[model samples]
Target: MTTADYIALALFLALWALYSWLTAGSGSRFFPRLSLNRAMAERRRNWIYNSLRRDLKMIDTQILAGLQNGTAFFASTSIFAIGGCFALLGSTDKVEDVFSNLPFVYYGGRTAFELKVAGLTVLFGYSFFKFGWAYRLFNYCTILFGALPMMHDTNADRAKAEIAADQVIQMNTIAAGHFNAGLRALFLSIGYLGWFAGPYMFMAMTAIVVFVLTRRQYFSDARLALMDPVSDTKDKQERDMRT
Candidate 1:
């Protein structure tokens, strides 16, 4: 690989890590702003703890099932992606031949092509592991959910119910954290595919991807919807009382 490829790769990795960190634990003093991921995490906590007061937890169980199913689906997708990358390795000759004739394509030679494929393989592999672990964590959260005191029992000792719910919430959040990491990798792979065009293209695409993701996490309509609007309403009410 040339110096430009190395620099591009480094840029890709650094942005990936930075975005991951920013979207992770929104409680960090460094960020100061909440991410959509963290906001959803709070909702998850509310969901679990709120179930304690309900007579039937069928809804909660179904939510848990949905989480497991979604994780499984992504995990399967990652596996398929890994298989596709491996298949690509076997067809590098054909790919290089095609690159040779395409005027718009930047043929980085066999070594660069192979390196790019290997990197893609690693990305998919990382996503697979993340999803796998997330699935297990969700399973653990299910068990923890089951261990939560029954509605009748919760009525007797609300504190105990709170403690148990907290456990499940933490497990669910951790599972979600892994799932988010995997999803982030999947999104970045789209940009990583740009390497076939050239390192500069790769760097440009990676930056574009990061910008899109950051906007979605921190400045999107989804984040606005998830944010609590009680403060504005409460302030309005206070002003009315003053009048």
Candidate 2:
């Protein structure tokens, strides 16, 4: 690959890192709004703690089950994606022939095509690992959730109950974080596929992917719906978009 190709790849990587940082770890409270996922994380904490004082925890258990199941589903999908990348690698000759015959195609030749396929393989590998880890973390979080005190115990001792609930919250949040990361990698891989077209195409498509992802995280209607524009104090309410 030429320097332009390398530069394009670097740009994609840089944008991914920057977006990850921007949306990660709950973000700043007052400047940028909390990412929609992180806003849900706050709700996750509330849900777990609120369950502590309730006699029945079926709802909370069902929520955790859904999280674990979702994680597992994505993990399985990532495996299939990794397999598809390998399938592409094996069919590079046919792919090269197809690209060569297309008048508008970039057709960077066999070596470049191989490299592009390799990059895709790497992307799916990263996604698979993230999803696998997220699934395990979700399982661990479920265990932690189960360890939480029952209503009788929590009623008798609120502090211990709060601490246990906090543990569940942290574990659940971390699992969700890894799940988000895996999903991000999957989305970016779609842009990486553009590399087979040419470096410029790669860079352009990656930017579009990043834009869409960031918009969903920070500015989408779902985010606005989850957020409250009114804070407790009048001045603080004007400053913060969360209640």
Question: What would the per-residue lDDT of candidate 1 be over residues 1-243, giving only the tens digit for each residue?
Answer: 789889999999999988887788633678777788988999998898788888788998998999999999999999999999999999999998999998877888998898899999999999999999999999999999999998899999999889999999999999999999999999999999988898889999999999999988876767776766674464345445545
Could you give candidate 2's per-residue lDDT for residues 143-242 as a string of tens digits?
9888888888988999988988898899888988889999999999989988878888899999999999988987776777666556524334444554
How good is model 2 by TM-score? 0.91
What's model 2's lDDT at 133?
91
Clash number for model 2?
0
lDDT for predicted candidate 1 compared with the true structure: 0.90
Worst 10 residues of 2 by lDDT: 231-240
Candidate 1 to truth, TM: 0.93
Which candidate gets the maximum lDDT versus the true structure? 1
Candidate 1: residue 235 Cα off by (Å)? 14
Highest-TM-score candidate: 1
Can you give the lDDT of residue 165 in candidate 1? 93
